[model samples]
Target: MKLLSSEIKNKVLESMVKIIDRERHNIIKANKKDLDAFNREDQALFDRLVVNEAKVDGMIKAIEEVRVQNDPVGNVISDLTLDSGLKITNKTAPFGTILIIYESRPDVTIEAAVLAFKANNKILLKGGKEAINSNLILEQCWHEALVENGLSKDWIKLLHLKREETQEFLRNPSEPLDLIVPRGGERLIKFVKDHASCAVLISGRGNNFLYVAQDANWEKTLKVILNAKTDKISGCNALDKVLINKNIPNYEAKLKELQHVLRRANVNILVDENIGNILSSENKIQEEDTWYEEFLALKIVLAEVSSLDEAVEKINTYSGGHSAAILTEDKNKAAQFMEQVDSAAVYHNASTRFTDGGQMGVGAELAISTDKLHHRGPLGLKQLVTNKYYVFGDGHVRV
Candidate 1:
């Protein structure tokens, strides 16, 4: 009976969604009863999202503004001609359903739903264990939007399940999962890539890099590294390693300055013995934390390379194929690093922290596509749709 009810709810939601745009701003403020439901049911979730409610609202407002100002990616391209008297054009279409399985990041629940909703796709969100309460709150927000607009909430349904359930879904692909985008550590994404039968988008982990080049301005380098690692140590964009040139002037003092900053921020520093002597204090970085570790906290690895070539090789070898940055005053050297390092977002004279879909000017974010295939960089609304050939022929079959 519950399954039957869910099917009914899904049909209702799909029908309503197909007609929502006719009314401008269909999602309005919720009524008193709805607000009460939000408050009373699962209050722990309220604690999580409510703490950052204003910030979430700001993101929503920004998304809505972008939705209004920007044009949709889909348009009928009808300018193809053939010598055999046939016109062939192409059209864009949305993926019908997108099943997302992500780890405990509350904001992603909202992010995925908004992106899917805007792209005219149905979404089934199954957030991992740590964010059960937080995900519930975010799911409720979408439900309110649907319910207040006189629509069913199935458009963005949250599959209430535990970690085991998600593993089952990945291992057994009987469900109608059009695409599965995994967002978490190497373990999570690897499980999905190995088990899931459907097409998958690897939102690979961030073993990102930052290089302090020989010509880099010491002051700017300090500010950039701090911003890169300290902006939000938990984010995927944060720098995991700092590569300094061995031949630079005041290298010891510069290294010491950064060490102090990392220590003050409460980050454990793993330094090579050469650079270890320069620091004011001694704090060791564990072997596990030193190599390809996304600390997501106050932590960094310091390594001294003999030359620029060595620095590039180290990054290319150890990088998680995510964002990488080089702080350098020398334009030529920066360009060289950008070209040599293999990652999705190669930044220069800037922090790797800005490697996000929203920051990259997409109205809605899907995830960073780590797999190099149909999509590679940050997945956005455009990546959500694909092309289909629309061949036009008047009384002309195959010649």
Candidate 2:
């Protein structure tokens, strides 16, 4: 809970950047062990588990980004001198200790720790068992960085607890837990919420939706859809559902064109009743639950909407409150959809993929938060700290 000077924190991050670069080969080797032991059936999970040279470079870049940015803690929010001769100043403060439970991604082990440590919060990483080896090596790198900067290894610890033990720890944490971020699917979020006795920030689940308005530019719609859905299937910002306005010019033909494009890209499509009629050969959505599903794969759902209101309503109801987009040349409709859709990030003629932290210019993020309590979008360095009121009074007392 001690506040570290910005110089020391940046020094640690500098060491981390050099250390990660030097240990890139060993890091890749450790990841190879995880990749070999992992089941390849879940392609999305498999892709997330891979930590190649590019990923290591990305890790180094993340540290560098956070390192150069302004330290988030102690920035003054507001200062006021009351009429009663009292001075009160609200300033940013670290959250003390944070626990982030995530799956597959070993980069979170670095990104989360760097952000939290830089913000003066001790982070406890609870990565999935599948990436144990990779995370262990990454944690070792973090420890080396911390020790090199004369900081405690406890500043960035990794929790190695099993399912039942995690449940118990969540229910009755051994140490103080200021904030808990569950960065995974619904099951994982539910597990953390059901047990954790601290404030929980929801992240990771992304049943993102995109609406193609009747006035949409056909070429742009197709491009956005293709990029959002297929560009990176493992990303949480990846598009999962597409709602096309039925009144769009040449609706049936556009639908067929979309199907063709997706087919060429090897993306499997599921359609609602109306879309099913047009794309008869494609599979129809079997259950209503399909609307709420986050397809973190080469899969997407195509549905029809009669109006912009309907598209907004459907997205608000079924989406994971992550990201939503409207493709329309009409500024009015785009503004309406952007205003009405209940999501952390809403786009106007842009791909839902822009919901990412780095893409949105937040630098290295802890996660893309879906929760609305403290934050609702990218959990970046600035978003990691809460506020504290510092009061200075001349022997004043409330009457």
Candidate 3:
């Protein structure tokens, strides 16, 4: 975290206080196309992006949330006493500027609103091509709100342009980027990690594993499988691989039934050697890439294995250290599965798709913490913070 002088910090606070009051519904009256400073292809690409109105409204509310005496950092967090006649206290502080690059999801724009506001930091958001239009509309709304509050509208930046701009922001090697977080696929994450000038936190990738128990319930298994694969195939947290223990009777039939549900949805299903079936374009599983890929479409990799141990071995080998799920009625087996799978989240009986910040009960999320340190799993408000300590004493000097 870059330490800030008290004057600059107060200026930022004053700016935020001014911006917050002006940003509500200022740009809602205009068409999203009005902010066409960028290209049309950008808007066309983002036109297909999926964002709920309620989610947009939530972003609108988040700006106001900062002014509502909310926990927007700098709050008194701790106070303590020591026997050496010392009084100690701890408080929160901002992490300076935050730059977040993510795949096309308008929801993230809303997330950025709450995140930058609550964290008391300036922010730049560069969304994926899929969310250009949605993002533009949002930026316009935000600009109007900020201007309404008597603040510079540029405090929140929306870098809407080519992919090159994203790299340019990351490649500022000499000037420096305090922190760079990439919230897209492995490819984008790798690109940012390789090129970023600042410390990179692998916000994580969404690849999960699920293994069936020896005596799994067929109906429940099918339901769980459907929800995991089809719930939101485009999300990083979607389940990617499934293992069926060979010890389970009629494993093939159960797997096939699950395949039937997927195939009916036109989802691409890939198979490996354990499937005991040949691969073709008919949704039959094949190719090792299936395990490593997050299709963001209706697709999954199907594999069969001998035991929970084998399932664990496969996941540890291929998982992106994201989330995984398992379905079984046996307590010991669930415990073992949970113990062995090295994922950010290990689900029992629930869909691997539910391994999300929103589903975990947080009102909102910045991104999935695919990284092991700093932030992991669902990234809520708590993850946006760090604590600092202060101590006081009367004429006490250390020897």
For all candidates in order, the CA lDDT equals 0.69, 0.93, 0.67
How close to the true structure is residue 23 of candidate 2, measured as C-alpha lDDT? 97
* Cα lDDT over the full model 2: 0.93
Off by over 4 Å in 1: 1-51, 69-73, 147-152, 280-289
Off by over 4 Å in 2: none
Model 2 per-residue lDDT at 247: 94
Residue 124 accuracy (lDDT) in model 1: 88
User: Tens-digit lDDT track for model 3 on 1-399?
Assistant: 434343433344344434433443332322243334335454322432544445445554543433332464666788889887888899887666677887756656656555654665566778776556666766665565556555566556787658776677677632335566687767888889877877677877666777887888878888888888777666677777888887777655666677778889777777776574623334554456667766666667777788788889999888888888788898888888898888888888888877665578654667778777777787766667666788899997776
Higher-lDDT candidate of 1 and 2: 2
Clashes of 2: 0
Q: How many backbone clashes does candidate 1 have?
A: 1
- How many clashes show up per model? 1, 0, 11
Give the winner by TM-score.
2
For model 1 the local lDDT of residue 367 reads 83
Clashing pairs in 2: none
lDDT of 1 at 333: 89
Q: What residue runs in model 3 are displaced by over 4 Å at the alpha carbon?
A: 1-48, 51-72, 75-78, 129-133, 160-165, 173-176, 278-287
In candidate 1, list every pair of residues with a backbone clash: 267-298
